[model samples]
Target: MRTSRTELLLGRTLLVVALVLTVLPLLSMLSAALQPADRNPTGLSWPSDPQWINFVTAFQVGHVWQLMGSSALIVLGVVPASLLFATLAGYALGGLRVRGGRAVLVFLVLGLTIPFEALIIPLYYQAQAMGTLNTQWAIVFPLIGLFMPFSVFWMRAHFVNVPVELSEAARVDGASIWQEFRRIQLPLATPALSALAILLFLWTWNQFLLPVVLVANPLDRTVAGALTFFQGQYYSSIPLLNAGALIIITPAIVVFLIFQRQFIKALLQGAVKG
Candidate 1:
């Protein structure tokens, strides 16, 4: 039953290669970001006189703080609401096994097959019709709807694996379904919920197209979405552009690092799922 040493060695080698591939680009970016503003960074070579102040300049020019605030507002609107509704839907379909749940799940799963690119045109017109175009709410509302299928599927994956006996026991004890979900299954779903929150946060944060299309004012868009405008505005300065990009992505990296344990725990928990 033990893993062979040769298999272990090959696995470790693959992981090392993957890590190197990931880190190299980030190192290249950092090296480029440290070079003097208005100077062409030829490649990934470290600058002899690194200009760390370029970050400060990029921040001011890019309005990094304001972009961050705008992105934060959109994320706050989307993730929590998505989580709540998806969890409820997942519970009903996966745990409660309510009538017609499979039909509902099938309908939701169909959403997973439809590309966001395909939906953008209709969504733009819908936003315009609803008079939410050029506002963050335009992006916010669509993202929540767009995120629902995957979010429900993710939560359902966790819930479907819950022991049915627990639900039966709760019912026999005269526990209402609400009480059972809130006090029992919900507590046990922490890992799934934590992982889902992180994923939704990352996706919503890096979401570029929706914000770009839905919100006309670049400053009103998410940071990632506004990078196009940022690039145009900072066209003369490669270093400053890289610095601005790094500044924008750093928060996502930090959040992932901080909660990586929960993320991994959820993965491990789901590994044996049906």
Candidate 2:
């Protein structure tokens, strides 16, 4: 059915309203970050003289470069590892019928329900006992496990929708399971995996609690985790704090901007089946 003029106008108006709601706060924060670090600016108004050096001041005082390095290392470790494991597990559960597969899927569903807050204390003690406390591994290891539920679910959703004929064709050609996965299914699953990687990278980069509890040094913390300590020290400095916040989130924004097309494609890929 063709949409009426009134419906189109209403939809556009709603979208514009939603866009303004989302962009306004970001503009306000960027505005605030341009003010002098020592001066406290209130509300969302343009600064008389933008202090570009506020970013430099925040970068220096917050050790943002070091925190960024730490976050990069963590993202490198977490995203690839999580993607690899989740892909294999998703293939097993979604593409193949294995013994006890239902039970395993149920367990993962349960894992998703368990709140991170409830597990933090136990994870802390476990890290302490394993002597991994205060190390980057402390953060990297738990993140992989915590990410498994959602990652597996995402890949499995893609895998389940894949036609069985593709797998059968590979098998008829005398291809082993690994060979089939490597040569056939994986190529078709690229969009889904790319989307998953983007989500995993953002989650790992923004992880705050694990680094805070498990890692002791501010330098060792992820950028978002380090933000807590930075805030405590510079609570009085609004400009620097806002600048630091922007620096920490910039990577995630950039990644989404770059991969947004793939991300949208992945979401829409499964929307229709022939």
- Highest-scoring model, TM-score: 1
* Sliding window of 10 residues with minimal summed lDDT for model 1: 225-234
Instruction: Kindly give the stretch of ten consecutive residues in candidate 2 with the minimal lDDT sum.
Output: 225-234
Q: Look at candidate 1 and give me any clashing residue pairs.
A: none
TM-score of each: 0.95, 0.94
Off by over 4 Å in 2: 1-7, 229-233
CA shift of 253, model 2, Å:
0.4
**Per-residue alpha-carbon lDDT of candidate 2 for residues 57-109, written as tens digits (9 for 90 to 100):** 78788887889999999999999999999999999988885688889889999
Q: What is the Cα-based lDDT of residue 32 in candidate 2?
A: 96
Candidates in order have lDDT scores of 0.89, 0.90
lDDT value, candidate 1, whole model:
0.89
Question: Model 1: per-residue lDDT, tens digit, 1-274?
Answer: 8999999999999999999999998898889999877788876799899899988888888887888899999999999999999999999889988899889889988999998899999999999999999999998999999999999998888899899889999999999999999999999899999999999999999999888778878888888854575566587788888888888899999999999999999889956756
